[model samples]
Target: MLGSIPDLLRLLAVPVFGWAAYRDIETRRVPNRTWAPLAVLGVVLLLWDTYAVVTGPTSGRLFFVQVAISLGFVAPLAYGFWLIGGFGGADAKAFMLVAVLFPAYPTYYLQTTALPLEPSLVGVFSLTILSNTVLAGVVYPLGVAAGNLVRGRFSWAMFLGKPVAVERLPEEYGRLLEDADGFTRSGLDLDALRMYLQWRGASLSELRAAPDAHRNPDSLPADPNPPGDGSVVTDGGVPASGSPDQFGTAGTADPWGAERFLDDVEGSAYGTDPETLRAGLELLADADEVWVSPGIPFLVPMFVGLVAALVYGDVLYALLSALGLA
Candidate 1:
């Protein structure tokens, strides 16, 4: 267990570092106060690592090789991430600290450090594709499964992290950003902005006629409960001339499209805060469910491909006796 301390530290740092970056994106300000402490922590950890190297049970030569090689591996990674805006300054610094903390960050470089340029290049290409495919294949399918199993998965989120919801329709056309009530005098509190669908209708039936009713799929909800007789249609009055039948399209043709037409009926009639709140509440309560994927579900294999250059070196090592990179 003690031997895994560095790995544990590295793993722990990811969420801390990533969440801080996320907060900055949300607030448009990355507070120096939060990062100052992490910077100090990084320094302390690096110093501790150096001290451990000097005093630990490992032989001096073995320790030196590990430290130097690890540093070599991480330097390039840090430089690359720096070149891309994907990592903010704080994120990069924290990443370096994480690399130092684990000691394995650089050691992973051993996979390709000594290979001939040609084979190493091939491995790099292979690994890059592998890693990307792995991440996408893993993250996307997982998100879908999780989305289906858990109805409210992030449903209550108003601003919803980074996915800006569009509420434009026949009445409020092209005014999505203007109509958004996400920002308040107190500033953004993500909970305030649960996703909402609005339609222009004096009565629920007219809402089904909106032209966009069939195209935007994710915006629609699944089958909704039938509305009560004396329903309060959505605010701003429903359109006088629109109804799903006016468009002459079969209601059941597309599940996604059908949901749009249904939302109009639901929202137009049951359009009050209580109705919206009730539906939103029901969805939000389902958040605890875990979405199960429809596959072997292991994502690590994809990551193995991200740095495919390792395979090139591995092949060379196996065939040419070249002690190349990992």
Candidate 2:
């Protein structure tokens, strides 16, 4: 019964990791609500397993010792990664939960075949998953490098990135990998400011309609009077009635029309927190096209790691043995 319970629980992990990977890919954010149920389930099963082991056999004490070692080692290691920005909150929580769920290899699933190495090397399921995850992560960069080489743009530092038109940048799919060449303003977080603008319904067309509007009506110079309705104005003293095409068209040297539209929005909305707005505008002005890296949604790799641990045991152990190094 104890053996079957962990096997079933290990199967349960597939759906949980799948959902997390899907949500991470789509939104780049994982809600705590997703992890909570899995954590609870893992904890309950862990306690039940602990009870069964303690009551069962001479090897029961060894089971408890393995649990201690797995939890003691993995929990702090996950926390350290979180502290160093190597792992996101959700990723760290998932790793620790994995230690709780599968304190030892799910041996019931390994009925006929033995691991390539002595079981001691990957006694803990969490350690096996971590090793698989690291191997998978390394493969990703090599794939990126190969693609860059094929494209004839083989720079060592930039092999993982591709140039993208600013207008084509998805709201959250990729991160701007390079700083704007000539842009120097610093204060607010540009990413947050972009999110704020979208939330406020301050669209590009609306900002283009009145480029000189400021959040504060008093900041306008004498040349550009605030519209009677108190709409924000641009910094260049341009009123709302000006032409939208003043910012330039797409695919040209001055192909930052969208950015300039955003700049007007920032200038109009610029208030006590103008520094962030200024920094964002400067970043936009840095280049016509910017290098962006489609960031690896970590949950995808976590999911892969879980699946690999179940089917292959420790991948590194298998590889080393196959190469005659083990």
Highest lDDT scorer: 2
Summing lDDT over every window of 10 consecutive residues in candidate 2, give the lowest-scoring window: 224-233
- Model 1 segments more than 4 A misplaced: 1-32, 104-326
CA deviation > 4 Å runs, candidate 2: 1-3, 109-122, 182-193, 196-280, 322-325
- Scored by TM-score, the top model is 2
Query: Which lDDT values do the candidates have, in the order given?
Result: 0.36, 0.60
Question: For model 1, what is the alpha-carbon lDDT of residue 111?
Answer: 46
Please give each candidate's TM-score. Answer: 0.32, 0.69
Task: Give the alpha carbon lDDT tens digit for every residue of 1-326 in model 2.
Answer: 23476567667888989998898787666788887888889888888887777777666766776688779998789989998867878889888888888788775434565432334364777888888888887787778778777877644335556666654442435545555342222222324434333433343334334544423222222232222212222232323333222234233332223334334445443231444444433454434665556667788887898887776678888788889998
What does the lDDT come to for candidate 1? 0.36
Cα displacement (angstroms), candidate 1, residue 113, comes to 33
Give me the overall lDDT of model 2.
Answer: 0.60
